[model samples]
Target: MKQTALKRWFNSGGPGVWLSAGAVSIAVIMTIGLLAVIAVRGLGHFWPSDVIAAQYDVPGQESHVLVGELVQSEQVPRARLKGAGLPVPDQGPEFMTRDLFKIGNRDISPGDFSWVIGEWLKDQRKPAQLMTLERREWGNFYGYLVNVKEDGNVIAQGEAAWPQLQARIERVQGISDQLDRLEKGEIGAINHGIERLRLRARKLELDGKLDAAAQADMASERAEFDARYKAVESQLAALHADFNRDSLTARDGNGKEIEIGIGKVVHAYQPNAMGTMTKLGFYFQKLWEFLSDDPREANTEGGIFPAIFGTVMMTLIMAVIVTPFGVLAAVYLREYARQGVMTRLIRIAVNNLAGVPAIVYGVFGLGFFVYVLGGSLDRLFFPEALPAPTFGTPGLLWASLTLALLAVPVVIVATEEGLARIPLTLREGSLALGATKAETLWKIVLPMASPAMMTGLILAVARAAGEVAPLMLVGVVKMAPSLPLDGNYPYLHLDQKIMHLGFHIYDVGFQSPNVEAARPLVYATALLLVLVIALLNLSAVTIRNRLRDKYKAFED
Candidate 1:
């Protein structure tokens, strides 16, 4: 009876249903697990970790003090440690515990990180007075504060020095903000004006209209810009002098006293002295900085604001370009085109295009869009900027166009399916009620299909935002300190190169010089990228659902 019942269940497709459910459950579990791992590794980096000061007693090496946060711990085979020339005793356990410490002070130390065998670390402690200096250069400085100085004169020492140092840092920060505004705002505008004047002169020369009057006018503009720049430069000079006026002395783990300029120190904190609430506030502050600041230290540190901006801007531009084109193509194929052998072939071709490798699109975009179309546009319209290759270079516009082309197939297929789903009676009834074919499509058919168009866009955005390969060839750069969109004339600079989060991940994870420093950033950046794509898709999905609900009565 049991065998007969099992056979009956198999024939009823019960096994297949259970197997499918199990597969979906496993996939969901795996995705959640991966996200959890990325969150823990990436988000934990911002927390104010207590700094450990320890005595190192490695065999055959002189004993010294080590200071920094404990970065990671691992178990390694003793044989591997011995092969690496660490004096590991082979008579004990097969595996030995190893701890990696972030021993910052890269300018003075051999490296920023060190690995010490667990058994050899002595007198490990987190002292409340131990200080960690987040710097503008050389990674970080881990030590004890000695005194604060103004110019060459010592003003505060010992416990009093900490508050004095903090006050000076705040003052320097204000000055730094002012200097940044002057340089990037005032000076930058003047420099841009001068360049524009120069370009105008070149264009006149090319047009054979470079008379004495034009030259005089160009020169006058150039001189005006120079005068403004001079004024801004003077302000900048004074700010710089003030910025460099104060300094602080700190004693390192090796008892060497080093003086760091106030302008160069970004943050100074005693992690061991921080309360739970203080640490939480500090964590949020660091996280915000990471999201808002430009990258430093060869993309190993700082924020990824540019990457975030570029990714969103590019994806949005691609959507704007692709939606109408994709929808139009789908309309022609499904609504107007004669149902013949050619129609079926075109549909097949589009479906296959969706499966093409993204790198192929990148190559095509570089060759055709950047070199051919962009070069022609530059020559005809921007002859003054020849050889500099304005539009002919890899930039934001080309990247967006490339991604649009790559995503068009998905949109076309989705819209076609939506169009096909609408009952023929609707179109017939619209025509019977005195509506033309065009009117039927516009008033009766298109609105119902809007939901499907959005579904296609959601898919396209999800795919395009995470695409790194094609963008790398077309526009994405390792460093783009100057954003494509700025306060310059013709504000949205589509021809300017921009950073992208996808390429940032690739560069930081694979191309960074500091592997240990880049690892956590990679995870953090990956998580951010995921969140960005999710947000984009979520917006599209919301629109699609609303459209679907609005047109539901028609379908019902």
Candidate 2:
């Protein structure tokens, strides 16, 4: 009875009539729930960028809690002292920074970047036995520093002897004092004069019953002087601050280990060298400074504008390139070409091309464009720009071209479908009125198919904007110091390196020297890329939908 009733209920019509619907619904619900959790946690990690000051053990002089003697590298040179046949030394172990690599299980791989610096952290009045991240701990970190090309080379096994921090600080302070004298003499006087002038001007401006022309002239002069004064004052203030060292700060926390924030922060450690990866080690404070600061160092430090600019520019170039070729191919196939085996073959080829791996396109682009064309052009036209390479190195133009190839199929398919959907009578009517084939195509078929063309373009833009692999093979730089297009003599230097957010993501996550510092930024850049792609799609979709609606009544 129960079985029959259950079967009947399962077989019932409407909502009751179901097979695998419950399973599907449950699966979907679970999928959505999981995604929601990941998004919430992942996204939250990228926000609230604050940089707090932290100090390590005063350089050189360190306390050892393990025993009365200072803990040195010889104390426990390797994590597994017995296995290495190197027992923890009886004398205070003098440690090396790279030695951290031998310490088992403390891999910063998933976390990304290295934040080890050899310094002192004053935790309370007592010199807390803080593990210095860089100098002292670097020896331990060397094992991990071993990369694909070099093993045991990047890291030194033994402790490196260097002048103590106390000595270095004294020398630095001596120079700093001399610099301070110059500031006090020249800078202080200049600032004082400007302040006096400002006060005088304010008083004069407020003086009543002056002639209109005199008033106008005075106001203009005062404004100009004020602007110049402010600019100089700002620079002076910055100079003053740079010379001053920050005092130690203390705070009471809820004993809560703060959740590390992930977001974009831009700084350049290396000024010269193309494709040099400047992975500035992460600091909690660095993150906050980046968010609130404007770009400097030729728009390098404290700003991610260059990376953001490259991403936008590359996407635009890709879209412009792909849209025309894609739509044209689509138009020819749908409107001009006759339906036959040849057309079918072409369509099949296009569909197949779309499925080809994006990375493969990168390889093809590098060979054909960078090596073949770039080399040929360099020889013929730009012989002067020879060894440096005008178009040889993988850069912006190649990246854009690579992306365009990837997007072409999308545009072609969308446009072809749109063209097919147009009413036959529209074309026939135009032809019947003695309009030429070209005229009919331009005035009738194209207008009707535009929505589809727009749709294709939008899709292409979204896909190309966040592409990384093809860009890797092409012209995306890890750190493009100067953008491709700048206010230089030529204005548009096509051969120059360009940055991309997608590449930025890879660099911050994998290539940064300061992985701990860059983690939050990696997440932020990913989120930004997603938002940007969505925005591109949204804008394109809005236009396409509007065009579709406008033509809907004609179709009806």
* Clashes within 3 Å, all models in order: 0, 51
Among all candidates shown, the one with the greatest lDDT? 1
Per-candidate Cα lDDT values, in order, are: 0.94, 0.57
**Worst lDDT window (10 residues) for model 2?**
259-268
Model 2 ranges off by over 4 Å: 1-303
**What are the per-residue Cα lDDT tens digits for candidate 1 across 1-556?**
9999999999999999999999999999999999999999999999989999999898888999989999999999999999999888769989888999999999899888888898899999999999999998899999999999999799999999999999999999999899888888898788888888889888999889999999988888888888888888889899999999999999998899999998999999999999999999999999999999989889888899999999999999999999999999999999889999999999999999999999999999999999999999999999998889999999999999999999999999999999999999999999999999999999989999999999999999988999999999999999997788879998999999999999999999999888898999999999999999999999999999999999999999
Q: Which parts of model 1 are misplaced by more than 4 Å?
A: none
Residues 1-556 of candidate 2: C-alpha lDDT, one tens digit per residue: 9998878766776354354688789899997786565455434442322122233342334542110111122233434443544333345434423211112112322321222322222242211221121111121111111111111122111122112222333443454555544455445444545554454444455555355776677667667666765765676566445434311111111111211100110111111111212212233344444443333322222446677778888888888889889988998888779999999999999999889988899999999989998888877765544466778878777888889999899999999998889888988888999999899988788877889899889878877787788888788877665557744335666677787778877877787665544554666666666766887788888988998898888788
How far is 173's C-alpha from truth in model 2 (Å)?
A: 22
